[model samples]
Target: MTTPQDPENRPPQQPYTPPQQPYTPAPPPLSDSELAGYGQQRPAVPEPKEVRLSFFLWLAGAILLVVSSALVLTQRDAALEEARRAPATPGITVEQLESTVTAILVFLVIIGVVLAALMVFFAMKARAGRNWARIALTVLGAAVFLYHLIGFSLVGLVIVLVVAAAVVTLYLPASKAYFDSVKRAG
Candidate 1:
């Protein structure tokens, strides 16, 4: 008794047919080299000559420090004699003066050797493209310059000049670029 307009009177329904999608290719997988876990190869940038030269200069400075310290110690006897000839302090005995002078010279020699070793180590690290190392070398160089400024001796003049030159070379345009590149690569 259902009418044609009723739900039970409607024609048999057809299954839905979805519209086809256009074909698109899948993206290729990442290559082994693209993986960060795999060690990334650093670019091969040749070291600038200036850096090499600066390293050599630092090495020379270190050697000079060691040799100069030894030489200064050898003159301790003369230094003591000069101290004796100079007017003695009111109550300080010659023996006491001698002991104090000897202690000071020995302390200076120990400082010299330690400074030399530090210079060489910093130079090596700087040459390997460590900017911090270069900066440290500069600070140490400034120290040497200041020390010489106070003493103002012939040997000190040479040492100061050498360190100054080495520091200068590190800041040259090519050397700066080299260090920058190395920094970026690592």
Candidate 2:
């Protein structure tokens, strides 16, 4: 019964088929962190008192910047008066003097308020054990310290002292260990 093309075959060979396997669904991917090795949860670490104190100091610094700016603003009238009474340069007029001083005061107030907002942000992030934030704060604190050193004003002195304390607290042994733990966990 074989065809002429398979003259030696007694019957047509059966088609080949693979053995069946059980169905299994693949695992779904969860949220991934922007930072490397951040998605995996790690054992909890207790925060140290030094870190808390530093956080408060940062908040205080922010408040001080705002208060000092407001206080400086309060002296606007005196500053304007003094400018009016002072020996005048040949070209500047009283109207020009008042406007310029007022503008400068407004600009300074805006800067102070903005700086205070930034302080709060950095403080929260650093307190949460963000290594980058802490490092950034350190750099900023050093810059502030150096800037204040060049001036002898009361406001600058207070800000510098507060920043200096916060920076010191961040570098304390307990704070260092906390940051290290956070890094390891990340």
Error of 1 at 29 (Å): 20
How do the residues 74-137 of candidate 2 rate in per-residue lDDT, one tens digit apiece?
Answer: 9799878887888888999778898998998888778767777777888788887887878878
Scored against the true structure, residue 48 in model 2 reaches a CA lDDT of: 88
Candidate 1 residues lying further than 4 Å off, grouped into runs, are: 1-44, 85-87, 149-151
The digit string of per-residue lDDT tens for model 1 on 1-186 reads 955688787799998999999999998987876775466333346679999999999999888878777767887898898888888699998789989879978887787788789899999888888899999999999876775564456888889889989999999999999889989878
What lDDT does the true structure give each of the candidates? Answer: 0.85, 0.79
- List candidate 2 segments past 4 Å from native: 1-43, 85-87, 142-156
TM-score of 2: 0.70
Listed per candidate, the RMSD to the true structure in angstroms reads: 12.8, 9.1
Candidate 2 lDDT score at position 118: 75
Can you list the residue pairs that collide in candidate 2?
Answer: none
Give the Å shift of residue 142 in candidate 1: 1.4
